[model samples]
Target: MRSALLTSGTVALLFVLNALFTGSLVSGFAMPPYILQVLCLAGINIILAVSLNLINGFTGQFSIGHAGFMAIGAYASAYVTVAWGDRFRAATSFLPEFARDGVLLLFALAVGALLAAIAGFFVGVPSLRLRGDYLAIVTLGFGEIIRVFILNIDVVGGARGYSGIPKLANFFWIYLFAAITVVVVSRTVKSSFGRTLIAIREDEIAAEAMGVDTTRSKVISFVLSSAMAGIGGGLFGHYLMYLHTNSFTFIKSIEIIIMIVIGGLGSITGSVLGAILFIALTEGLREFSQYRMVLFSLLLIVIMIVRPQGILGHLEFRHFFGRRRRLAAPTPPVIP
Candidate 1:
């Protein structure tokens, strides 16, 4: 009962924080709801980073086609939502009493995630055989294939893009998923499976010798990570109510990678911090928008030069948030 109370309290605290961050507080900023968009995008990016971190940072794989998985979800969800939206509203003349107005939209997002997971499974199966740069190349090729496929698929509006999606991705859903992502990932990383994943990263040969199923771990991590990316993509698509093949290109994949890389490859908290920082920095650099990428590139180079391992490489949450364990109090200096 105490534990339950604590859990409920934490949830309530998170709810309050979400409202404050997402709701209108100050009148002078005039930032609009787009800040919520940034928050959602950052949350999704954190998932992608942490999930990919499991592979690259913990499992020592080099998969790089995250954006492809995201595209799959976005397109899949878009198709269902558009088709169902047309039919449901047309037939019923309005949403049923049993249905919230946003039910279709939410369902479509889930469907997007499901389809993306399937795609991730297929892609992971093949790419799990490759390692390092070879795996990166293979994943890159897969991303391109997805992009090309979307470009030719007229059902999703092809290159011209799809629009008219209901904008139902508010802060509530976004941060809820974000919190869930963090909780799930943090728990997973603390499990035996996560330890084995880290072992694989430390030395795959050793892990294999110790009976760790390296390939299976890699595939699972990749699929889960890809699924999260897909969900993010769906949120992104619905938020804009429009999406184009161009949005989920190789460059987008690289940006996701950069978030992980800068955030400290293996650290979930770092990913969240990094994503928020990246978005802020990108937006802040608007003064030199033309040279924003250039400036970012220079910053990355400097960080790499100074700390090639990454900014917060592998630092756990306890390092940042957990209470400090005091050393034994020197036996009170034998005061007696």
Candidate 2:
């Protein structure tokens, strides 16, 4: 109870601090627009990395198709806001005007998450049974399938791209959801179900022998991961007020995977760090123009060779907070 209270208080304090820093309260002095944009984008990337970590990091599943779920969420939320924003707001106009728009955006996020979860369930059923490269192939195929379908769908702009979506996603919402994603994922990972996932990760055969329902665990991971990605996607689409089928392709999925890998698998804090750095790095490298991708790829190869476990290597934020490590006691007492 004390720990939970501390966590909540910390989160609230963070929200307050962020609002102040962004001048959301004062309204006169504020961060530069580009900086704010980067921060929002970083928040969204945090959600993406953490959600993908739930599958690839915690559950030991090598999923490479997270972009599909993200795409589903993006399009679903975009459709809601674009095709039905006014209708949703009108239906809730009885509430204060500010609250009414909030309700609409929240509803859109919920619906988007639901759609992604549904997609996850079906994909998980078959994909969960595979392992390693096979699983990667299945996921990659799923992402491609989603992209191709969206490309041909005229309703959501087909190959042209979606635009003019209501800009419902602001910095506040992005940071709020990013915090929620971290908290929920952290608590869930420390829970019993999360242990089963770790067990599966460590050794599937051994975990099965110990009565862990590996299949069920994998499926659950997929669903949860998908749902969070969907939420992130909703925020992403609305924030930009535009999306294209090409944006959610396999390459995008690769970027998410790279963030988790570079951050360190199975570390929630690592996801946060990785997301921030990844986006900043990409954005900062824009100076290279055409050669940026090549440079980024080369850098990744060097990092992988030097530190394969990632930047954090399963370390949590609390681990760096001066928590004492328990040393094993001498066996001399037993001899006596």
Candidate 3:
């Protein structure tokens, strides 16, 4: 009951904070739209990093094709919204315009996630048998294939890109889903299944010897990660109101992996922190766009040399900021 109440209160707080960032409120406060948009983008990146961490960090899978799933989700969701958006709005006649669009946004998001999961299954099932660099190579190829395929498909504007997608994703949806991603991934990492996944990560042979289905767990992790990335992609496409095949290329996948690595692999909180800091850095250096890549490469080298484990390493931020409770002393048993 306490936990339930706490969860509800947390959610309420998130929504309240979200309302403060709405266009009207921001305009009232004279806050810039770019800041709001960046915040939303950061939230989306957090979702991507956290989801990818589930597979790479906790599950010990080296998947370089995350952007492929993102592309699938983006294109799929964009197509659905463009083709069937009016139908969805009309079907939700009882709802307010904003509420109706929100509902349909969620539906479209789900559609994107489903399509990504299907793609994950096909990629994961066959390639999961491979390990290490082989898996990485296969995933890289997969991402490239997806990008090339999308470039040729004129239906989605092909190489020209898909445009005019509904701007349904805003700070509210982005942050809400980002929070959900963290919570879900956190809970999942603490569950029995998570332990199994971690065991596989620690040592696949040992885990298999212990009767854990390494391949199965890997596939499950891959699929779950892909689904979340897809959802993030849907959010990204809708927010930008455009989709380009190039946007979901190998470089984007590298960016996500960098976020997870610099945040601290195998740590959910680290991934979130990493995404936040990484985006902030990227934005801060936006003025030096020409040298941005060089600057980050140097920074990464510094971090790798000075602090190999990243900002958090294997520890949670809670360890630093959270209030610590004292353990109660055990009462002495009375024999008499």
Candidate 4:
């Protein structure tokens, strides 16, 4: 009950802040459009990073095809909104315009996430049996296959790219879903199921010897992660009102992997921080234009050399603070 209340309050607070930023609640006051766009992109990246962290960080699966699932979600959701969105809006016309649009967006997102989950299940079942580099290869191939498959499909625009998707995503919806992704991942990590995943991550053979279904746990994690990625993809598509296979390439997958690595594996808070910092740096370095990639690569190299375990190193913010508190505590009297 307390958790529910806290979640609700947080959501309400986000809504109000989104309204204020968008100037819905204040006269002649609004965040700059470019900044707001960056924030929304950060929210989407948060979803991607946190979800990938679940599969790769928490479960130690080493899958790097998140962009594939995201692509699936983007195209699937775009198709729904492009085809049936008007029908859904008309059916829900009794509600206020905003509410009706929300419902439509929700339905489209659900469709996209569902399809992506299905893809994850199929991919996980066969490919998850492999480990380490083999697993990475399989997932990499899968992502490329998805991209190529989408590229050939004329229904979704083929080489022309899919367009005309409804622009229903906004700051409120994006951040609300981002917060949900974080909560869901954090709760899962603290649950018994998550503990089993961790056990597998630490030692798969030992976990299997202890009667834990390691493969099954990994598959479940993959599916959940893919669904979350799909949600991010859906938001991305709707916000841009377009879809392109080029956007979900191997480089995109690498970028997400880099975020988790820089943030620290197996740390949810680290994933969030990593996403924010990654996006900020990418945007901040835009002025360097010709030298942007070189500068970004150098900075990442420095970070890795200085702190190889990442900024947080498998620890959450709470854990970090608690450790400091313990260290600062007075020493107990020696009985001598």
Candidate 5:
């Protein structure tokens, strides 16, 4: 109950912050539009990184087709909003305009997440049996296949890209979902099911021998990860009011992987920190746009060489603070 209350309070506080940032509550205190865009993108990246961590970091899966699920979500949600948005809004016409739009966005996000989860299940069932590079190859292929498939679907503008999506996503919605993603992934990591995933990551064969349903656990993780990614993609689509297969390519998946790896593979705190840093660095280097990739690559190389295990090296924020508290505590009197 306390945890639930705390979560609610945190969400409420975030809502107020979002209002301030968007100038909904205080026009004088509004953040700049460019800054708000960067923060919104950061929130989406946080959702993607944290969700992918559940599969790759916790479940020891090497699936790299995260972008495929993201694409599915983006296009699926955009299709709904473009095709039936008016109907949805009409059904909820009694509500204020903002509230009606929010409801429509929520419904679209749900559809995207559901479709992505379904795709994840289908892909995970067969590909998850393979380990390491083989799984990665399958997932990579899946992502490519999804892109190609979407390219041929004229209903969604084919290769031309899907446009005309409503701009319903705002700071409040994006950060709210990001916070929920963090809470869900963190709680899962602390649960018994999460222990099973960690055990599988440590030793799959041993975990299987110990009677853990490794396959089921992995598939479930994949579905949950995909659903979260879908939510992120939904927000991305609505925020940009566009959808393109090019955005959800193999490179996109790699960026998410880099976020988790840079933070610490097995740590949720690391994922959040990594996503923020990655986005900040990317945005900060916009002035050198032509040489940005080269500079980014060099910086990543240096970071890897300096701390290959990641910024946090599998340790969480709580662990770090707890260690500090322990060190600061007064020493007990020794009886001589």
Candidate 6:
């Protein structure tokens, strides 16, 4: 009951804060409302980066086709929302009409996640045999293929892109999902399954010798990560109210991977912090325009030189809290 109350209180506080930002109660040199947007983006990217880190960092699978999953989710959800949303809204006129307005959009988001998960399984099965740079190339190729397919597909507006998507994304949904992602990943990492994944990362051959189903584990991680990335893609699509194949390109995947790498691979906390810092830097440097990417590259190089392990490496919250408790404990009387 205490935990539940605490959760409720936190949620309420988040909602209130969200309301303030949305209402433009806060303003500054940086359009404060846009700060909320950056937060939302960071939250979503945190999900994507952490999930992908499970595959690439924890499991040592060099897959780089995250953008492919995002593309699948984006177009699939957008198509469903625009085409069948109004129909469902009309058909469900009986239930408080306002509810119907956004429900379809939510349904589309679910469908997007489902489709992306399915795609992950498909990609994972075939590509699991490859590893290292080869797997990276294959995954990169997958992303390119997805982009080309979207371009040729007329149903989703092809090269012109898709528009008229419902603006269903807001702080409520974004943070809610973000919290869910963080919790789920954190719990999973602390579980036995996560141990198996780490073992695979350390030595896949030894893991297999020990009867661990390495392939199955990799596929499971890949599917889950892909599904979450899909959710992010859906959120991005609705938030923008329009999307193009260009949005889910190789560079986008690279950017996300950079988040995981700079944040500290294999660390969920690192991913979250990394996402926050990356987004802030990306947005803060917008004024520099042409120099932004250059600066970002230089920053990464500096981080690599000084701290190649990434910011947090694989440390968890327990590390700091545990230390705090030890420090706070009363010291015994010193011997005379």
**Which runs in model 2 stand beyond 4 Å of their true positions?**
1-24, 322-336
lDDT, residue 239, model 1: 70
**Residue pairs with backbone overlap in model 6:** none
Q: Which stretches in model 4 have alpha-carbon errors above 4 Å?
A: 321-336
lDDT per residue for candidate 1 within 203-238, as digits (tens), equals 889999999998898888888877877777887787
How do the residues 16-106 of candidate 2 rate in per-residue lDDT, one tens digit apiece?
A: 7667767876779787879889989999999999999999999999999999999999999899988888888888878998688678889
Cα shift from native, residue 198, model 2 (Å): 0.7
Candidate with more favorable, higher lDDT: 2 or 3: 2
In model 6, the runs with Cα more than 4 Å from the true position are 1-3, 24-31, 322-336
Ranking by TM-score: 4, 5, 3, 2, 6, 1
In order, the Cα lDDT scores of the candidates are: 0.79, 0.91, 0.89, 0.93, 0.92, 0.84
Distance from true position, residue 91, model 1, in Å? Answer: 10
Question: Tens digit of lDDT per residue, candidate 3, span 1-336?
Answer: 997897788777766666776645455663367888888889999999999999988888888899999999999999889999999898899998889989988999999999999999999999889888999999999988988988898888997789979999887788888988998888888898899999988998999999998888889889999999999999999999999998998999999988988989998888998898889999999999999999999988998998888778877766788978678989989998
TM-score of 6: 0.90
Candidate 2 vs 3: which has more TM-score: 3
Candidate closer to the true structure by TM-score (higher is better), 1 or 4: 4
Deviation in Å, model 1, residue 162 alpha carbon: 0.7
Residue 147, model 3, lDDT: 81
**Predicted candidate 6 versus true structure: per-residue lDDT over 79-144, tens digit per residue:** 888898778887888878546755776788899999999989988899888879988998999888
Clashing pairs in 2: none
Error of 1 at 105 (Å): 3.6
TM-score for each predicted model, relative to the true structure: 0.87, 0.92, 0.93, 0.94, 0.93, 0.90
